[model samples]
Each structure stands twice: as C-alpha cells, then as structure tokens.
Target: MNLDEKMLLLATCFLFLPYQIASVGIACILVQAFCRHKLVDAIKNQTGAIFLYSFIGLEFIVTILHSNWTGLGNTWLFVLVGLYGAYYRKSITKNTFEKMCDLVIILSIFAAIYGLYQFNQISIANGRTFLEFHIFNSPKRRITSTFMNANIYAMVIDFVCVMCMYRFVKNDNILCKIGYVIVALFNFFVLYLTGSRTALLPFVLIFPIFLYCVRWKKLFITSIVLELCVCGLVFLKPSLIPRMSDMSTFASRIKIWKTAFICISMYPLFGWGPQTYKKFYP
Candidate 1:
C-alpha cells in the first residue's frame, strides 16, 4: 500500500471515530474506483454486495420521492457497503483480513484504557463513589468511555476480549498466553463498567467455548465451577436473581424493533432510507 492508503488504514485504529474514519477511507476507495476498472469487477464478482446496495439505492430513491428530509443526507452512506467490497479487491492479500482483525484488537485496547480513565475522572460525591457494580439489578449509571453512549461502547468491547481468550487458549508460547490472559481480564472489567445487560452474555458463552475448544474435560469442568462461584456472589443481589421477571429494561429495544418491523411491512422492498426510523418511528 502507498502512504495515502496506509494512512487511511491507520485511521481505523481510532475507536471513538470508527464510522467517520471508515467513511473517509471509503471516499479514497471511490476515488480509486473512478480512476480504474475495479468498480466493474466489484459489481460483477460481488453479487451479495450488489444485492445489498441495490436495496440501499432503492431506499435513497424512495426517500427522495417521499420528501423525507431527516435522513436524506446520510442516505448516501449506504453505498459504502458495496464500495468496501471494491476496496477489498483493490488490495488482495491474505494479510488484509488479519490486519483488519489486529486493528480491532488495538482499537478495543484504547477504548478500555479510556474507560478506566473515565472511571477515575468521576469525583466521589456525598462520600459515595458513582462507580457501583450491580451484577443482577440495573446500574444507576453507565460509563460511556469515548463513545457517544455506553451501549455503543458495549457493542465493540467484546472484540478484544474474544480475541485474547482465543490466543490464551491456543497459543503455545507461555509469554503470549500470560499477556493475553491479562488483556482478557482487563476487557471483562471494562465490559462490567459499561453496564450493558446484554453485553454480559458474550463472556458467559465465550469462557465455556474456549475451554471446550482446548479439548480438556477437566479444565472445562473446573472453569465452570469457578464461574458458578462468581455467579453465586451475583445471585446475592435479589434483583439480579429475578432479572427476567423485570421486563422494564428492555422496553426501548422492544419499541425500536416494533417500529422497524412496521416500517418494513409498509415498504417491503427497501428500508425507511437508512436512519430515517428516528423520524417516523412512534
């Protein structure tokens, strides 16, 4: 890759502005596509991308026809999905995918460190720290880290944790194993502080999967026992024990999904033009 492309790839490491950086890179890819014949190849060879972007293109046209002013500006971004396929073809190499995975890990590490910094930045008030841990009940507040919201932070937090866990379980090198274990623990701590109830499910499933993949029955059973002990501590919180009975927390998600389904039913061929759900959703 040239210096320009290298810089664009480097921009992907910023966890706080992932979408913005990716959009910039997509712009570069589009510039390159105009100068060469690769754009034709992306359409002809990448049928899946073509299908997805065709719908996205339809949505943009529909939004203009409907005069939906809310998400009209952002509607152009849907084309980037297909553009990325073109970008991948521009730099065909096995290491491209591996390097992308590495960037995700690096981005996650930066996010975790920022979260810890945010945790310390909170000043104690009335002799009580704001960073409270409630394993079962909903937390009073959540740490957003560098993201716009804690839930957005939660979505990307698992990337490094799962990566480290796989390395810790499969690596033959003892030093690498130790390093990955430490990173994995730090990821779990950050995941907890995010206070995203749904995000916790990854660790619940990841640990068991890693142990099972290692192919040691005794190790798997021992890990389960240790996890159960941790769960017992959380169970002491009464609300945590009956979280399923408390359905109030999922109200926003249910409403969002219902709105999306209604919109899709109304316009089955295309979505409500990218982020237009915010405008029309009840």
Candidate 2:
C-alpha cells in the first residue's frame, strides 16, 4: 500500500479512533471489489446483509439528525467488510485467511504480554508509561492490552479469541490447534484484566451460538436455555447483576441517540448528508 494506507493501518491499534483503521480496511475492500466486480453481487445475499445495511443506513440517519457530516470517513468499516467479502474469492488461498487469523492472535498475545509487563513496572522507552494499565489518577494498573484502554483492549482480544478458536476447530493441524490454545489463554487473561462486566457477558452468551455454527445443534439449544437462565438470574440476583444499568455511563449515548433521532426526524429524506453526528451532538 501507499504511505497513507500504511499510516491508516498503524492507526488501527490506537484505540482512541478505530475509524482510521476502518478507513484503510474500506480502501482495501474497495480496491479488491474494483478488481473483482462479482463479489459486490455476492455480498447482497450474505446472512448479515440486513444488519450491515442498517448499520450504514443509521449513520446517514444520525448525520441527518445532527446536521453535520464532518470527519465521516470513519464509517469505512462497512466498505471494508464489503471488500473482505469480495476479496476472499479464491478459496484456494486458505493460508491467507489463516495468516490473517494468526496476525490477530499474535497482536492479542503481544497486548497481553505487554500489559503484564506494564503492570509489573517494566519500563518502556522514552518515559512513555503504559497508560492502559493506569487506574484513575492513582496508577493502580488495569490491563488495557495495546489499545490504550483496558475495556477496548479486552474487546479486541475477545474478538481475536473468537476468530482464532473458530479457525482452530476447523483446521486439522496439531500445531495450529496448539497455537490457538495459547491465543485463548492470552485472550482470557486480557479479558479478565479489563474487569469489564458488560464485555464478559457477551463472551459467555455467544459460546454456544458459536459452537452451534460448527454443527453442535444440541449444544446450541442447551446454550439458548442456559443463556435465558443467565439472563433471568442477572435480573433476579442483585449481587450477581452485571453493570448493564449504569445510567451515567450510558447517558451520553442516550443523548447521542436522541440527537440522531431528532436530526433524522427533521431530515428524514436524503438524511443530513453524512458524518454529521459528532458536529450535531457537540
């Protein structure tokens, strides 16, 4: 890729703004799509098509609601997904996909190891402390992985863990399976370090669904029942409850949604152009 694209890829791990990485991803996808036109048509029939379209559509809605579309380049995530769908046309290059999976695994492992080191007071270069592990103003560290914040770091690791586990289950190699075990342990450590209750819930709930996809129908059904039980218990037991009801934390999100709703109401047709949510929200 060019220098700009390289910068975008580097920016992906920055965490304060993932849209930068998304932009690069979109660019890659678009480049691939142009090279292979058939993939665009194929994308239309995929299972997550509705959700994907809706997600993109909602961004426009938010822009219209807020009457601002500045810095909207970040929404390239959808474009990248589209590109990815098309680019993997040649199934013969299974190694490429495995490599991508491996990259994610490596990144997560690096994050975990770095986090551990940071916690242990292992000095980094040039007076740059690992900010992810810092708790509040006191420096009581929390493992933020490499994303600069523990929760986001954990989420990234969780994502990688899922992908790696899926690949491990499908692949026949013993070494690959062992590598996945390492990835899983590293991911689990990072997840625990974050102490994000909300993030952990989805991980537990999605396990059975993921297994079900791999032909474990009975396990899938059991997971559904177990998920319900988990939810019910969460509602009933005050002490065991997850932090899903923190109004102050989610309040800004509510405002953002409300603002988007009002903007969309005002300009339901054509929407407020694009990337206007931040401008309007502010």
Candidate 3:
C-alpha cells in the first residue's frame, strides 16, 4: 500500500481504539503540518488558524481526565503542530487546508449516519461499532450510533452540523441550504436520542449567540422566551421530570475530573510523565 493508504488505515484503526476523535483530528493536523511545512506556515499566518491551534489546549486539558498513551500522543501532536507553525512562516495558499476540512466534514457526516444506524441495530461485523467511534461505552444500551458512546456521537454530529451551516450560509445555492438544514435536523435528532445534558448546553448557548451576532435581536428574544415557556411546561409536567433527570453525567465526571486534578496537582509542572492517569486516577 502507498504511504497515503497506510496513513488512512492507521487513522481508521485509531477510530476503533480507545482514543477520542478530537484527539485523532489533532494528530492528523500534526501529520499534515510536518509533511507540508508550507501549509503549517499558512496556518500560522491566519488569525483563525492560530485560535484553532490554541483551542486544542482545552482538549488536552480535558483529555487528561482519561490520560493514556493515546491521550499523550494527541496532546503532543497538537503541541508540535503549533510550535512548528510558529517557528516557520511563509506565504502559501490555504486551498489544501480547506480541502482537508471539507473532507473531514464529509467523513463526519458519514460517521453521524453510521451512528444513527447503530442506534437502530443495523450494523455488520467488520463494520465499526458506534461505541468505538464515540470514545467511551455507555451503560444500559445507550444507542451510541457510530461512536463508543452516545455523548461523543452527539458532540461530533453537532460540530459537523455547525460546520455545514457555516458553509451553507456562505453560499447562495438553494440545494446546499436545504442539505444543510436536513443534516442539521438529523444531527439534532441523534443528539436527542443520546439524552445527554452536556450535549444540550451547546444548542442553548450557540443558538442565541448566532442570532445575536446576526443582528436578529427580536428573534433572539422571542426564541429565549419560547424556550423559557417550554421549560415551564416541562416543569409543570411531572412525568417529564424523570425523563429530564435521565440526562446527566455530572456526578461521574466530577469524580473523574477530581481524580485527574489531584494527579495534576501532585505532579504540577511535569505531569505524571504521560499515560499515568490510569495508574493514579481513582
């Protein structure tokens, strides 16, 4: 197989491994940066690109809660990419980077569709399980779709939907706009199926941000009021309360985060020397 084919196989394998998709994406960015120095320089020159590279740190921080070899590799990849970009700057076209992003979006859509199929139990062997894509397994048959867990599936689709919406907004094509809406609805439905409280927060936050940024103040206020009314209705319906309570991982995550924080505090400057969270995490 060619080098490109080998890399694709490795990426596919990693998708099934116990690592996060976001981490895998960071790794891909690192590989791209090293192999294409011109692309790295272009990224460094772009303000938004710089922000994206900086944003990877937040992923690293959160992934520390479940630090493993994969987690370390992801973090190091992100760090190396940013450092390399900073050290080298040159004028270069961003067409390749944009093409790569388009490919990622296409793959993410497929992942979302696969996740939906998994929820429906329409999967074959030699095919990836939804749980593997999601990054963690859920208890009581969570319908993870193409992910290891429903939450990851929801998160990934949500981001994909957002990117699609961004692209749609920039184009005047009716078909593209319709496709974006369809994809967005599909992602929203999958997220609802996951019943993840954390997944819901982004919708609550981002919808308003988008409306306000687009200068739709009246519509924004109306949307907020409508949401409040819906919440009130749900609050009044006692049966809905139990369903609402079904969507929290706060306790479990708090426990994990606390353990990880303790490890970080203990090691402070150097951390537990990579892949040590499991050894020390409670």
Candidate 4:
C-alpha cells in the first residue's frame, strides 16, 4: 500500500484508542496530505465537496458572530477528517478496504476483552459479583476500555457487532462463521456491561431487519427465543439490564432534546456556534 493508504489504515486502528493516542492518527493524515500536495485535487474530486466546504464556511461565520472560539478547533479537525476520507476513498483499493475492515474487527475484539478485564477488576475491588456490578453500579461503574467514556465504547462495540453479524450471515466457511458469532456475542455482552441505553436502541431496531434480510429461519427463531428470555429476565429484575429500572435517565434525555430543539429554532440557519449548545441550553 502507498503512504496515503497506510495512513488511512493507521487512522482506522487509532479510532478506538484513547483520544490522546488517537490524535496521532489525525496527525498522520495531515502529514500525508501535506506530503502528497494533492489536497486541492482531492477536494475537487470529492462528491458533495461544495456542501461540506460551505458548511465549514458557515460554521466559521457563526463562530465569529457568537465569539465562540472554543469549537473552531473541532470544526477544523472535522474538515480535515472529511478531506482525508475523500482522498482515501479515491485512492483505496477493494482489497485494502477489506483489510481495513478486518483490522477494525480485530481491534474491536481486543477492546472488548480489555473491557471485560476492567469489569472483572472493578467487581473484585468492590466485593461484588458480576451481576451485582452491572445491576447496582452500572452507568457509574461501567467499563470504558481504551476510550474515555463507557458510552463511546458501547457505540464502537455496537458497530463491530453489526459487522460481525453481517459477516456471520455471508461467510461460507463454517469455522469463520462460528468465529464471527463468538466475537459478536463477546462484544455484545461487553456492550451490555457499558450500561448505555442509547447504544442498545440501535441494536433493538436493527436486529429484526437484519434477520429479515438474511432470511435464516433457524437463526430468526433462535433470536426470538433469546429475546423472549431476555424480556422475561428484565421483567423479573429490571435492574438486571442497567438503567432500565431508572426513569430519570429517560426524563433527562427528553429534557435535553427539547431544549436542543428550542436552541436550534432560535438560530434556524446556522447553529449558535459549534459546542455552544451547553452554554445556551438552559
């Protein structure tokens, strides 16, 4: 692979790492872009480049108008990542993309293992059983793996679980299929340990559609049985699924969303400025 391709792979691998470490991936992309001197061509060749550039421009305008410089750095980083994606898309081969996906799956599995280790350590330190750790301490005692937050870790696991499910359905090799299923389940359990209600929402919404698309009768039946069992467990002990017993989280989310909509309505065209939502959210 060329330098750009190598940088793209590096970036993908760094995605699940802690933010401090992940900054290296962003630097790699920027350095590669500068070395290649093809950034202008990359912008020109990318589809919807105009819209992205316009959005960035508008963000800058809004930032200036509101004097909210705190978010401009993030805005610039977002632009850089988008530009790098366009360049990577134009240059990447099918085989390289497949390799990148495999790397992502491998990294995700490692992350899940680490998260499980974190869970075990925390449970031991607190003199609690695994179930107790999740039921009573979760959303507070949740594992973050390499990321800074449990919710972010859960989101990443959610993506990997979907990819593993897809691979399990499509792969012809029985051994490979079994491996995918094992990895998927492993990551999914770790996801549950995260106590992220939002992350679970997508999985609940997607599983039926996925089963329908694959049309595997045995698998579909198995999933339904598993779902019913899980529902029964939750019904008996709502705390078994972390945060499910708590209504306050739902109420807080609704309030936040309502406030966010109100803020957006106040500045319908451009946002009040990136990262300014907290300041104006009340």
Each candidate's lDDT (Cα)?
A: 0.66, 0.60, 0.59, 0.78
Residues 117-155 of candidate 4: C-alpha lDDT, one tens digit per residue: 888888887787766654333455679999888888988
Which candidate comes out best when scored by lDDT? 4
What stretches of model 4 exceed 4 Å from their correct place?
A: 121-131, 135-140
Residue-level lDDT tens digits of model 1 in 14-123: 43565667577676766776567656665667757757877777777878887776556666666665666555565555454445555666667777888876655442
Superposed model 1: Cα runs more than 4 Å off: 1-11, 14-18, 33-43, 89-96, 121-141, 169-171, 214-216, 238-248, 251-271
Q: Score residue 31 of candidate 1 by CA lDDT.
A: 72
RMSD of 1: 4.1
Clashing pairs in 4: none
Sliding window of 10 residues with minimal summed lDDT for model 4: 131-140
Candidate 1 weakest lDDT stretch, 10 residues: 132-141
Q: Candidate 3 or 4, higher TM-score?
A: 4
TM accuracy, model 2: 0.56
Error of 1 at 75 (Å): 3.1
Q: Where does candidate 2 clash, by residue pair?
A: 29-83, 64-272, 65-263, 65-264, 68-276, 69-274, 69-275, 69-276, 133-142, 144-150
Query: After TM-score superposition, what is the CA distance of residue 112 in candidate 2 from its true location, in Å?
Result: 3.5
Error of 4 at 50 (Å): 0.4
Instruction: Estimate the lDDT of model 1.
Output: 0.66
TM-score of each: 0.76, 0.56, 0.62, 0.85
